[model samples]
Target: MAVLAQDGGLAFYGEPDEAREWFRADRIEDIYLRLAEAEEHEWAGRFGAAPAPAPGPAIGAFRQWVLLTRRSLDLLTRNRLTLAVLLGSPLMVLAMFAVLFRPGAFSPESPSPAATVMILFWIAFGGFFFGLTYGLLQICNELPVLRRERLTGLRITPYVLAKATVLLPLLAVVDALMLGVLRALDRLPAMGWGTYGELFVTLLLCSLAALALGLLVSAAVTDPAQATMALPMLCFPQVLFVGAILPVPVMAAPGRWLSCAMSNRWAFEGLGHSLGVERLWATGRSPLGPPLLDSYGDTFSRAPVVDWAMLGGFTALFLVGACLVLTRRT
Candidate 1:
């Protein structure tokens, strides 16, 4: 290194003062500048030949997944208010469910058909709500950082998957907790583990679909406030068209058509099928059973797998939509 001074004096760098100058040019600045440049290059030379190793394709994706998921989990856990709301929501909903529904709604000999329907519907809605609320605020608030990451070779698929990877487990736990608490409280029937497993799967799928929808919305919106505003618009249709409030057969023609698009409808019907709500309503002691069953028509008659498949389809569609929205936004 070399520098020329204002006075036209030159100094040689990259050498001890007592040693021969390493460079051919001696048009350096002052002695202080020469020493500084020499010190800088001496340090730089140590690392100049060594470039960062590139990770293999699979390993690179796995590494990104791990890091992104870790960062998301850290941010989620550190926000005490957010953490409380996420975990507390199920408990609060459980409390309301506990208060609203009396025990043995699923009791075969003396069933309360109305309570059973409400229970299944609300559980489905709860799963949907949990997934949606968690995902809505996730991407919108991080747009600036996400844009910078995109410039640094961040893959959108892995980036979006990481959000699911972190959040889905939490959703699983909450869904399980919702069922366990309700069952323990006799809000749900004494079904076998297999039945509970089916219920859990249905609820989890419902949550996954909602999560994907929320991610799509989050990626579409520009900020958290917009995301917040989107919630009611996203939710109103789910609540109204899910066939919980009004049986699908009884809903107006357009409402019935829109009900086909709501993931919660599948989930609720899945739960009902898993618990055999149709049979219970048809044969149970409650006089209310037959009338409600007539209103619901064949809603819960289809196999739960069909509903599961629908939920899975919704998840895939929403995920692809989210990815497209994000790619376009970027």
Candidate 2:
């Protein structure tokens, strides 16, 4: 008998006369049955072993979250240029704004409506811009690796949360610095600790919402270049429709409706209300104050808690979107 390999199995290949001599008709069935059994045994030995047991769901999930978060933090720390940009850009923005606005802009005694508005705009949008930049490139840059890991049982929730976990604290630090620096420069008025805490919470929520938006964009896009291109597209609406540049009441009907959707609008309004922009601008000595207040038209009249709720809603919405996109892709 001549053994030949054919289609991943052993076969007998010989001249017709040789094959006829090797196995007569009566024995051929038995010989073929034995050969089939042997092949089955060989295949079972090579490839049919039982899989290893998986860990319990709770333990597995915890382990995955810790590992992924640590890995993400490590990756963030190692990227020096990105880290520098994240920390530096906000400081630069703060410095430029400080120069642009006069001191005591938002003070109750001598408020500058324009200056107060500008200061509030920058604070809210600064946190937003920082969060956006931090998260925009995160997922798209590591999609291939994420895809590979997903095959080994990666969960989208943990993956996204890990990214957020590593960056949220960093965002807090950046925000504190922004506020601290401006206050030190006398660009922002000193406030009670309770008021400052309220402002910080508002800014932090804005950053969280923006970060979620960035991650959503990152997951939906195919590459970092696409995400980078999307940055201005995302930011322009936030800046234009947030009622800072153009008061919401003054916007066209469609623009008015759109302004409601901008997270920055809520954050801007929240900060303004928290800092008494309405009272400051409406009653202050500046002639421009009342007109600006008229235009704003109850924009900041709502409670800061309402803005906080809206911001939390946006954050949840974007995070859900990111997870859905990642699940579909991976």
The most accurate candidate by lDDT is 1
Score candidate 1 by TM-score against the native.
0.81
Q: How accurate is candidate 1 locally (lDDT)?
A: 0.86
List, residue by residue over 1-330, the lDDT tens digit for candidate 1.
Answer: 333333333433233432224332354333445445564455345334544446444447778888999999899889999889989888898899889889988898998887888889899999999999989988999989999888767878878989998999999999999999999999999989999999999999999999999999999999899999999999999999999888999988999999999999999999999999888877888889888898989898898899999999999999999888888888
| Best by the TM-score measure | 2
Residue pairs clashing in model 2 are: none
The Cα RMSD of model 1 versus the native structure comes to: 8.0
Q: What's the count of clashing pairs in each model shown?
A: 4, 0
> Could you tell me every candidate's TM-score relative to the true structure?
0.81, 0.83
lDDT of candidate 1 at residue 123, scale 0 to 100: 93
